[model samples]
Target: MKTLWIKLLLWGYAVFSMAPLLVMLLSSFRPTADIFDDPLGLPTGPDLGNYAKAWTEASFSTYVVNSLIVVVSAVLLGAAVSLLAAYPLGRRRFAGRGLFAAYFISGMTLPAHLGVLPLFYLLESLGLIDSLLGLILVYAAGSIPFNVFVLTAFFRQLPYELDEAASLDGAGPLATFWHVMLPLVRPAIATVIVFQFVPLWNDFFYPLVLMRDESKLTLPVGLTHFFGEFQNDWGTLFAGLVMTTIPLVVLFVLATRQIVAGLTAGMNR
Candidate 1:
C-alpha cells in the first residue's frame, strides 16, 4: 500500500508539473480564435504555419543565432578558466587554500544587484555597452564560481596517485591539468555545461540592462516584441514560446540521464 501510494504521488506530481507545458504545446497549434473560444481544448492538429509566422514575423532567426553565439562562447571560455582556477584548490594544500576556496564560493552568495552599478560603469568606460561580447563576459563571470566549486570537488575525488604518475612521466602542472585531471573530470564538465548553458541561453536580465539595440537582443528579451501595452498576439506569442522551449526540451531529453549521473556521482565521495 505504501509503495503504491509513493508511485501515485510521483505520477500525480508529474501530471501537475506537465499540465502547463501540455497546455502551451497544444495552444501553439491553435488559431487565436480557438484559444479564446476553448483555451484548454485539445489542438485540432499541428499547425506548422504558426511556427513559420512566429519565426519570420518576430525576427527569431536573428535572436536564435545571437543566443547560440553567446551561450557557446561563454560556456567554453568559462569552463577553461574555471578548470584552471580549480586545480590548485583541488590538488594542493597550500596556505590559505580554504580561505581561497571560500572566496570563490562566496561569489555564489553575493547579490547580483550590488555589483550591477560598478559593472555597468566599467563596461561603459570600456565601450562594451550594447555589445554581445560584453554580455558573454558577464555570463562567464556569473558561471565561474559554481563551475569552479563543482570541478574542484570532483577533482578532489581522484586518486592522488594520478598526479604522482603524471609527475613521474615528466608532466608539469599545466601538462598534468590538460592531460590528466581534465580528461578525468568529463562528467563534471558535462554537468556544468548543462547547468550553465540553460540559464545563459535564457538570460533576460543582463541583456535587458546592457543592451538597448534591438538587433543585439537575445531570445528572452527579444520575445517581448510580440507584446504591446494594450494588446498581445496570443497565437504568435505562444508559438514563439514553444520555439524557445524546444532547444532546452531536446537538450534535457537527450542528456537527462547523464546530468543526473554527473550531479550524483560525487555525492558518495
Candidate 2:
C-alpha cells in the first residue's frame, strides 16, 4: 500500500510538472481563435500550418544554426582548454599550485554582473561585439573555471601509480595524458559536455548583449520577437516555444542514462 501510494504521488507530480509543456504542445496545434476561445480545451483538430509559419516567419532555422555554432565552438574549445589546465593542476606539485587552483576556483563564486561593465568595454575595444565569435568566447571563458575544477577533481582521484608506470615505460607527460588519463575520464568528459552544452545552447544573455541583428539571434532571443506590446500572437508564439523546447527534450532523452551514470561514477570515485 505504501509503495502504491508513492507511485501514485510520483505520477501526480509528473502530471503537474508536465502540465505547462502539454498546454504549450496542444496550443501549437490550435488556431489563434480557438486558443483564445478555449485555452485549456483539447484541440478539436490538429493544425500543422502553425509550425510551418513559425519556422519560416520567425527565421527559426537561422536561429538554430547560430545557436549550434556558438554552443559547439564554445564547448569543444572550453573542454580542450580545461583538460589541459586541469591535468597540470591535478597531477603536478609545483610551487604555488594550490594558489593557482584557488585562483581558478575563485572565479566560480564571482558574479558575471560585476564584470559585465569591463567585459563589454573589452569586447568593444577588441572589435568582438555583435559577433557570434564574441559570444562563443564569452561562453567558453565562463565555463572554463568550473570545467577545470571538475576535471581536476576527477583527475586527482585517479591512481598515481598508473601515471608512474607509464613514466617508467618511457611515456612523457603528453603521452601519458593522451593514452592513460583521458581514456579513463571519458565518462566525466561526457558529463561535462552535457552539463556545458545545454546551457551554452540555451543561453540568452550573452547573445542578447552581443548579437544585434535579427539574423544572428539564438532560439531564446528569437522567441522573444513573437511578442508585441500591442498584441500577442499566443498561438504562433506558443508554437515557436514548442519548437525551442524540442531539441533540449531530445538531448535529455538521449543522454539521461549517460548523465546519471557519469554523475554516480564521479561520486563513487
On lDDT, the leading prediction is 1
**Please, what are the lDDT tens digits per residue for candidate 1 over residues 1-269?**
99999999999999999999888888888888888998899878878777788788778878888888888899988998998889889998899999989999999998776899899999999999999999889888889999999989988999999999999999998899989988788888888988999988888889999999998999988877655511355677777788888888987887787778777886776
Residue 154 of model 2: what lDDT? 81
Task: Write down the RMSD of all candidates, one decimal each.
Answer: 2.1, 2.3
Model 2 bad stretches (over 4 Å): 1-4, 44-46, 168-170, 229-231, 266-269
lDDT of 1: 0.86
Measured against the true structure, the TM-scores of the candidates, in listed sequence, are 0.91, 0.89
The Cα error of candidate 2 at residue 55, in Å, is 1.0
Colliding pairs, model 1:
none
Pairs clashing within candidate 2 = none
What's the count of clashing pairs in each model shown? 0, 0
